[model samples]
Target: MRILAVLLMLTMLPVASAKEPYKAKPGVAGNITSVGSDTLGNLMTFWADRFKGHYPHVTFQIQASGSSTAPSALTEGTANVGPMSRELKESELNYFASTHGYEPTVLVVAIDAIALFADLHNPIEGLSLPQIDAIFSITRYCGGEQPLRFWHQLGLEGQWANKRIQLFGRNSVSGTYGLFKQKALCNGDFLPTVNEQPGSASVVQSVAYSDGALGYAGFGYKIAGVKTLPVSPGDGPYVKPSMVNIASGDYPLSRFLYLVVNKPPGQALPLLEQEFIRFILSEEGQKLVERDGFIPIPERLIRRQLNKIAGDV
Candidate 1:
C-alpha cells in the first residue's frame, strides 16, 4: 500500500508542477498618461481600449496634440508615455536627460511609410524626391531644382497645365511636418504658399478636395478621394508606400514609430507602464497594428524591445 501511494504521488507531481505561460500580474491600479503625436493618436487609443480589458482597474489619459509636445510633457511629468511617429530629436533627449538625469526609453512600436497624396483625378503617377522638394520648398534646396509652382511645369497640358499646385501639409508642430521637411524638402523652409493644416487627416482631406492639390501624410490616412504616389530616391526605381515595400526598405520615406517612456537613473519602469509596453509588443498587440493599417514590428525587433524592457541590454 505504501509503494502504490508513492507511485500515485509521483504521477500527480508532474501535473502539479507543469509550468504555465507567463502573464503579467495585475499590480496596483493607477492612471497611465500618454501624450504627443497626432499621427499615433488613433493607434494609441486602440491600444488603450484593448489594454483596459486585461487591466480593468487601470485608467488611461492620452493626449495626442503633436509629437513636438511629447518631450515637454515628459519633462513636466504630465505624461508617462509619449507615442511619436518620429524618433525624438537629440535636443529633446537632452531635455529629458537634464530633468531626469537619464534618457527616456524608446521602443519602436510600428513601421510607417510617409505617403504623398494627390487628387484622385490627377494623371501624374509619381514624383522623385527632388521633384517633391521643388514642389514644397521655397528655395528648391534639395537639388537646386527649379520651383514647380504650376502644373504645366510637370508636363500637364490644357486646363490642368494652367492651374497652380495647391499644397497641403501638417503644421510645424507635427512630426509628419518635420519628416516631410527632412526627407522631401532636404530640411529647407516650406514654400510660403503651402497651406499647413493641423493634422494628417486634414492634409489628406485638403488634397482630396482640391483639383490640383498635393500633400504628404502617413499611409494610414489614405482615403478614397486621394491617390498615393510612388516616390523614388534619385538613383532608385519608384516604390509605392505599401507594407511589403516599407518592410523591404524599398520605400524611400519609410520610418519607425516610437513609444517614449521616462525612466530616471537606477529605476525600473512603473508597473502599469511596463505592463502596457509588454502588451504593445506582444503578438496579440501586433495584430492590432495590422488591423489599424500600420506595419507590425518584426519578431526580431520585438525580442530586442523585450530585452530592453527587462534591462538586459
Candidate 2:
C-alpha cells in the first residue's frame, strides 16, 4: 500500500505540473507596422497569417510603397519596420543614422532571382548577357524607328527579325529596378523606351500579351503565360529561373531580400516581429520560401543568420 501510494503521488504530480497554463513573455503584446518594398509585400502577408498563432494579441500592419521608402518612413517614425528587397544604399544609411541616430537593423529573409520574362508565343529560347545588355541599354535596338523587330535581329537563330521587341519594366521606385540595374546591366541606365509598370504581376501580365515583349521581375512573378529567359554570367549554359537553380547559385541574377527596422524596435512593438523573422529563417519558413518561387538561402547561412537575428530569443 505504501508503494502504491507513492506511485499514485508521482503520477498525480506529473499531471498537476502539466496543467500549468502556458504564457508568453510579459512584454509580448501590441501591434507592429511595416512599410515599403512591394516586391516583398506578399511575403509579409504570408508571415502575418501564420504569426498570429504565436502572438494572439499582436496585430501586423503592412504597406508597399517601394523599397526606397523604407528608410524615410523609419526615420520619420511613420513605420516601426521596413521590408526591402535591395541592400540599403550608403546614402540612405547615412541619412537614417543622421536623422534617427542609429542605423536600422537589417534582416535577410530570402533570395529572389530576378526573372526575365517574355511572351509565351515568342520562339527565342536564350539570350547572352551581352545581347541582353544591348537590348536594354541601346534605344536603337528596341526604341528608335528601325528597332530590331524580329527574333533573328536580336541574334536568335530563327530569321524572325521584324517581331518588334516590346520592353516592360518596373517603375523607378521598385527594388526590382535596383536589382536589375545592379545585376543585369551593372548599373547601366535604363533606355528611355522601356515601359514601366507598377508591380510584378502587372509586368508579368503585360509581357504575356505581347509577342516580343520582355520584362524583368522577382521570381515570385513567374507564371505560365510568360516564359522566363535563361540568364548566365558567361561561366556556363544559360540558367533557367527556378528555386533549385537560384538556391544552388546557378542563376546569376538572384539576390537577397531583407527586412529593415528603424531601430531595434522599441518595447512597444509587437513580439510577432521577432517571431515572424524567426519563422522565416526556420527550416519550415525556408520551405515556404521555395514554395513561394524564391530560393532559400542555404541552411548553414540561415543558421548563421538565425544566430545573429533570433539566437537569443
Best by TM-score: 1
Q: Write model 1 residue lDDT over 1-313, tens digit each, in one string.
A: 4321232233223222211223657564789899899999888989989888888998999888889999899888999898888777889989989888888888788878789999888888688999899999986777955888888898888878989899988888888888888888888999988898888898999898887999998888999988999998975778888998886657888777888888754566778888888888877688788888898866656666666676736
Clashing pairs in 2: 149-161, 149-162, 149-163, 150-160, 150-161, 150-162, 150-163, 151-160
- Candidate 1 to truth, TM: 0.90
lDDT of 2 by residue, 115-185 (tens): 88987767777776656666676533322333344566766565446666788888888888987876666
Among these predictions, the greatest lDDT belongs to 1
lDDT of 2: 0.71
Candidate 1 residue-wise lDDT at 131 = 88
The 0-to-1 C-alpha lDDT of every candidate, in the order given, reads 0.82, 0.71
Clash number for every model? 1, 8
Predicted structure 1: lDDT: 0.82
